[model samples]
Structure formats: C-alpha cells, structure tokens
Target: MLNSFDQKKQKILQEIQSDDLDLSPKGTIDELCIPIINLINSNDDMVTTSSCSGRVSVYLEGTKSNRAVVSKGNHGRWLFVTHEPHDLKDWTSKINFVYTSSFPDPNARLILYKFEPLILHVKCRNLETANKLYQVAMNNGFRESGIGSNFNVAIRISIKLDIPIGYKSPKDEEFEEDILNLFVTKDYIKYIDQLSLERFEENSKKLNQLYKAIEKDLSNGTVLTIKTNKPNWESKEERRRRMVKEGLKRQEELRELKQDQIQ
Candidate 1:
C-alpha cells in the first residue's frame, strides 16, 4: 500500500505529465526548471511540489480591492510575464498598459516590473531528509530556504525585484499607452528590461548551484560535482529490497573475507 507521501508524489508526477492541467499562471512548468525538478523527484526521499525557473514580469496591482486587503502579497495580477530574459520589444507591441484610477494618491495603485528568482517547494520522506535538503540548499546560496519540523523544505532565492513602473486603475482595467507614456519613457522601460535580464542570469546560476549540490548530497552524502545528465531513478522500496537480497548472497562471501583477512 502506498503511504501518504508516495500517493502525493505520484499525483504530483502525474500532474507534470499531464498537458491538461493548469495549476499556475504559467499554465505549466518552466522548461529551464525541468531538469532541477526532475532531479529532486528522481530521488527516493524527495519530490518537488512546485517550482519556477525565475521570471521577468509586468504586474498590475489593485490597491483598493477587497482581494488586495485579503492577500497583501498577491494583491495583483500579471499584465505580462516571461520565464526567459524579457525583451521590451516583444512586450511593448503586445501589451498596452492601461489605467483608469482617479484616486487622491498617484501611488494608490501600481504597475510593476519584476525579476524573480528560483522558487521551489519540496516534500521529503522524513524530517531528516527535509533537513538534509535544507542544509544543502542554504550552502548553495538559497538563503531563504527553510525546513519545518515535519517533512517539507521550501527553497527560495534572496534576490527579487518589485520595481514600480506606473499606476493602474484599482476599479477599471483599461486606460491607454498615453497614460503610461506620460510618466515612463521608452528608454526607462528598456533600462528595466536590461536590469531584469541580469537578474534572470543570476537566478539561473543560483538554481544550478542548488540542484548540483542536492544531487551530490543525494548520491553519496559527500563529494560534490556538477552533473551533466539525468540519473536513472529507483524507488526506495525497490532499493531496500535489492540491498536485502544482495546481503543474503554476500553473507557467506563476507565470512570468507573476514577469515582470509585474519589469516
């Protein structure tokens, strides 16, 4: 019988394999994040629940909405977002920023450009495994990583951007490019794009360091090296059964070796 962990793990994997599911704003996993996610899931003692490779985003926030009061961190929605280094040219032609708020304060609502870092959540087989992941993650520059007293570890990068570009309407979701142009210039938007790209590069590097560290730890509990390929995964139960079977055959061989050593 599959335990709770195994059931959850299987469900998560199935979700990954399915094309019909849309759990996040991205609608699916980020391609750059796939290898790392696969690496973690391939381990017998761990599975990734959620992950993001990192992204550059244009976000629109509603400061006066009831939803804003309830969810302070996510009181906004994405106007535009990209998992790769964002190009202003691609976005400018596609997204036309609009505002309809006529509040007393110009800062009442905001349109933001963001560069976010790797965000990963994992479920481990046990508390020990969670702590092991936490230690490796922190060592690899995931300063915001944490493991609970139970069996989950969330790895987060320290660097992220929430740069405000302009204001958006809290009530209505329409305005015009003229409103955005009134404040932010094309050159300034280009500057934001350049800065976001730098953050994206840094984020990718950090994610690589983390997964390599995790892979190293899982392989031998010591020794670290960058791996260029995926590993063949085996279930923990299967591994245990194989070890026990091998031990039976090796018992007589082990006795002979001890005798030979003594002689």
Candidate 2:
C-alpha cells in the first residue's frame, strides 16, 4: 500500500509541475498564498491540487419574476473581479453602465458586489497526513478545513474561510435612498461602492494574516498531529463478537445488582 501511494504521489507531482494542469480560475496560482503552497508542495507527503486567494466581484442576476418571462431565462453574470482593493469611481462607472444598459432586461438589473475568502485544496499521501494538515489549518483560523475524497484518492484536504460581503438589490430606489442618507451623499451608488471596497480590503487583510500563521507553523514544525474522525475497519464477525461480549457483560452486572438488592 505504501509503495502504491508513493507511486501515485510522484505521478501527481509530475502533473502539477507540467504546464498542462491549471488549478486556478485565471490559470495562475494566487501570489499571496504562493509561499504556503510552495511549502506544502515541498513536503513529501502532500501537494496542492487547487487554490484561490479570494476576490471581490460585481455581478448581475435576473429577478424571479423576470426568469419566467424572459426568453433566454435569467442567469447570473460577472461584471468585474479583483483580488486587490479597487477605486470607488471605477466600480461606480461599471455599476452605472450595467444598470443603464438596455441589453439586460429591466427586470434583470439587480447588481451585486461580493467578497469571497481564500480557499485551498491539498492532496495528502495518506489519511494520517491529511489529519495533521487539517489540524494545523483549523488551529490557524481555517475553521472550514476538512477531508474530502475523489473516488480512490481518499485524502483530499480542503481549507476554507467563510468571510462574505455583499450588497442586495443595489439598484432599488428605497435601498439607495437609505444608504444615501446614512452616508450623506447625493451619489449614493458611489458611496455604497466605496464602502464595499473598504470592507473587502479589511477582510482580505484578515485572510492574509491567517495564511501567514499557517506558513509560520508549517515552517517551524509546530503543527500538531490530531486524531481524525475516520472510522476504523473491522470485519463483520469481529464486530458481532464485540457486541455479544458487551451484551453479556451488561447482563452480568444487572444480575449482580438484583442479587445484592434481595440480600
């Protein structure tokens, strides 16, 4: 089993080094987490299969009422994406164009801005290695890390953080009015755009700190080995015998208690 696992690991490492494999949305690994990725890949027992440094995006989706009436049906479309902070004026122009454009049905004009968190998937050589990695990730603020599988490849470690930011019904008049009052701005759209950008920057910095923590533990060999919840294998006969023994022990205790009560 060890030999077979080693062979598979070598094959996967070769594929990762080759140019044919693209594990990122933009065909490039995230620069922010590149050091962490390199550290994991350097280990003999692990390799990263996919990763993302997270992003903020502007998108449009049709309303429920519009979905049934539209010929092509309602679908979400991304208008912009950035991994770093963006200017308020830049997003304001894009949002205005999307809202004012006639190509999208009037009912499909809800624009939204969103922030996503950093994510990474690591493939471990075995379940033990996966458990160690999962422990380290959870300790470093990646609370969503866990084990996933792909057919026979049993130990895929998923690392994720769930920091999300979004605007709902950005083009709604009442919503716009409320935000305009709060920010004291006649250009309420620009105000919201700037506000979202600032929040995104804050969340991005938090994610970066988490990454650095993980990298530090990994480099310093401080990651702890914790037992995972994976079940142990047992034959049907062995399980049946164990259950029978436990039942017999319980019966003996009950009889002893009854006898003592009678005495």
Any runs in candidate 2 off by more than 4 Å, and if so which? 1-25, 62-75, 87-89, 94-109, 150-263
lDDT of 2 by residue, 29-142 (tens): 445655556666666677667666666665544345645632222434444555656444555443434222122324534445555667777777778777777777676556
TM-score of every candidate:
0.72, 0.53
Cα lDDT computed for each candidate against the true fold: 0.66, 0.50
TM-score of 1: 0.72
Q: Best candidate per lDDT, number?
A: 1
User: What is the Cα root-mean-square deviation between model 2 and the actual structure?
Assistant: 22.5
lDDT of 1 by residue, 111-209 (tens): 667788889999999988888888998888888999864588889877887776776433333632223321466677777787778888888888888
Q: Give candidate 2's TM-score.
A: 0.53
Model 2: colliding residue pairs: none
How much does each candidate deviate from the true structure in C-alpha RMSD?
Answer: 18.4, 22.5
